[model samples]
Target: MLEDKNQEKTSLSELGEFGLIKHLTKHFSSYHKTTIKSVGDDAAVIDSSEKQTIVTTDLLIEGVHFDLSYMPLKHLGYKAVMVNLSDVYAMNAEAEQITVSIAISNRFPLEALEELYAGIQLACNTYNVDLIGGDTTSSTKGMLLSITAIGKANKEDVIYRSGAKPTDLVVVSGDLGGAYLGLQVLEREKQVFQVNPENQPDLDNYTYIIERQLKPEARKDIPELLKELDVKPTSMIDISDGLSSEIMHICTQSKTGCKLYEEKLPLDPQVISTCEEFEIDATMVALSGGEDYELLFTISIDDYDKIKGNPNLSVIGHITEENQGMNLVTRANQEIELKAQGWNSFKG
Candidate 1:
């Protein structure tokens, strides 16, 4: 009793990569004169002129990126925008606009969509960013969100990943691994709740770590502080994939190595307690736990005075020549090769 007996459906795989690109391009027409080229190059080239531009994009999928069981729609929306804005800050730029697109299944009610948008609006208000154009569509499965953020900076202010030099001091904003420990607490509580329905999970003790995981904030103030201190980082990267991975990225890109002092790795008291409770190595967590969203950068030794005694910052390591390789000097005075075991989605 179907209404459209002659209708045929096509699978995304059937169209292949090139075909899908063509199909999507057909629906869009260029409107900006600054778009020098689009859709068919190794990268999109724009006529930025005298102004410096920053570009960042993020993709959030159901199950992998979030869980409806604990993640609220509004928080998810806010987080989506915040994650992109963090990238803008990492580039030392001011985020001004964002384009959000979502693919949702029919299971989501209109009220749910409204709740999500409310979060997005909150982020826009907080960051002073405009809600630019985007698209909505029906998904074959669950919900998916993709956002592209654009920001601006002065020509001289833009930061890149390859500026680190030997002997520069490595610094990080905020503590690390709290977010990972927080997630662990949430998962443990979820398991406990599953074991007994009548028992309400007691998360009163793990509030700090849990909040660090669920509502992580980008280091928005670091850029402003840098300007005030007149210190430009020799190289910088955000701790999205853990400090070890990010440090490796900076070192590899700059053709340098580093020696991180284990005692210098910052850890919130809550993170220390939680890691102990879980019987996980706190140092390993600080090294490899992701989602801290802190800034990891290297500055010339001369700039050390600018950040010294700053409660929000810590000097963790020092860069070395590439031939020295990356190592961590433990509190026990043992040198161990640093390993980047940052979250790998494909490996589960």
Candidate 2:
């Protein structure tokens, strides 16, 4: 008789794409009554019932997406939900529900999972979103989280990246680059801890910036504010992938160009001071640092007057014809072409 080989292990890389998908979806079955179609198709079709539905998803991986050593499971859970909701807001829609799935290893304790759920529940309550359903599984490696957020919007009110036109004013909400600088502070402190276990982190001066990194809030109010002002964004995207990269995305999709002014870029005082302390260039940080979670949008020139004086909004540039290309003008009056050094997970 042949020996039993049921205990043999297989590598994920050996299975490749199709085999991996099969392995993952093997035990998953459609449980929702509204699910018209589930996996095995190019796209999953759902019953819309004449209502426009918005879909967004986010992926969080260990080490790359977060550092478990300093990041509490609760904050990690809250941030996972907030990041996807930010995308819904970018679409000018109201987020109503989310489905969360997690893959974890045996190293995590049951209490840790509970702490993570607590944070997720807090965010759901705060945003008034329903945690519809999800899947839990064992991972061969580290923790991985994926969230899919579903939102609703009227067909007429939906905003897309293709609506921007030349001469429209470019605007941004809140400040920029604080989160990236905060990460720098945290990493520096972590290094110190590794070198000397007895040394306590000097975090008093970096409280504001550090919070910006660990706990970023989505700009859910921007959509309501635009409605109150009787203005709709011609084009918009959240600033998760650095200011310059997001601006390029809007310009590319809208078939337009832009001229952003350095003097007009908003920076919090704490961000500037932190950059100075770390001996890093503030301008570079403002332009290329990611995870700000602010809104970058464009509006018709006529509507500029309504938003110009708004404390939460700042006009940083203006849209131009495609031939003009995207450029940034420095405070010294020199113009330079903008290039995006946004996060590339594969590269690093």
Candidate 3:
């Protein structure tokens, strides 16, 4: 939107790196008592007294992880934070701080960065995490963001991917496949725009899916909700990679196998209908679509009654002995070998 409007563009050189950092992070304030120091420091300090600290980092690059033609800079900033925070929440920890580093080319002006930082600040305020410290540098090509999120949890409360037991039930929060399908819609629209710039694509049917892609929220409430329900997950992971890939991560690390049922996958109504429109199998989308950001976890079957009626969670399947191997139970009652066909950066 900023690019479309003819407005004054301030050069980044006027602010310098330190000046720009100070300006961008001026609105950020610390919420957690653990944050000893926030922005404008040599290094941000946190006092995680008695609690275990969780740290997670993710890198997103232009023309690779995203396309600026379709992706807004503000949404990109918000999403960069959410992606890392999602990893922290996967460990059942509450994210308290994040240090965001970015490298941008000269094409982005001061106002452009201000818009990006506005989104970042909004995420911090919304999620109640502190913007601690980071570095800024000039890039030769395009924008690159690397965010490191810090979280805290009691030693006994932290969940690990290797903690799943054979009899534990596999559960997932919210729905799957919406974000991936959203990307498909956006990509299609981009192609259409290239062919006809004046063509206005009808996107009313894709509102939910598009929102899911642009502004995915990390499941910060899932851990708190589970604690409120007195249900601790045996093992947990956020659905960033596809369902099958993440499931395999848990199973391999835990030395266990799984039986994921195709029918049990939680799908939004839009996701189902969109899959039909795209002529893609909904089951395949649920299995291999990435960036859902929902938490997938395992719980002891003994606690089944507690969460049986929860609408936010879907009990997909159960863990099995390692020798049984990971398999997907089709709705037709046939077993298919589960494969990790999710996103792979190096696959040419």
TM-scores of the models, in the given order? 0.87, 0.87, 0.86
lDDT of 3: 0.88
lDDT of 2 by residue, 1-348 (tens): 455565576655556443476689999888776564344321133446655577788889998889988888998998898888888888888889999999999999889899899989998999999999999999998898999988877767767766899999999999999889988988888889899989988788888878878888888999999999999999888888799988888898789999999999999999989888889988889899988888889999999878878989999999999999999999999999999876655443
Candidate 1: list runs displaced more than 4 Å. 1-47
The residue-by-residue lDDT of candidate 1 on 157-244, one tens digit each, is 7676678999999999999998889888888777887898788888888888888777777778998898898999987778877889
Q: Give candidate 2's whole-model lDDT.
A: 0.85
CA lDDT, candidate 1, residue 317: 92
**lDDT winner:** 3
Evaluate model 3: give its TM-score: 0.86
Q: Candidate 3, after superposition: displacement of residue 314 in Å?
A: 0.2
Candidate that beats the other on lDDT, 2 or 3, i.e. the better one: 3
Deviating ranges (above 4 Å) for candidate 2: 1-50
Model 2 worst lDDT window (10 residues)? 36-45
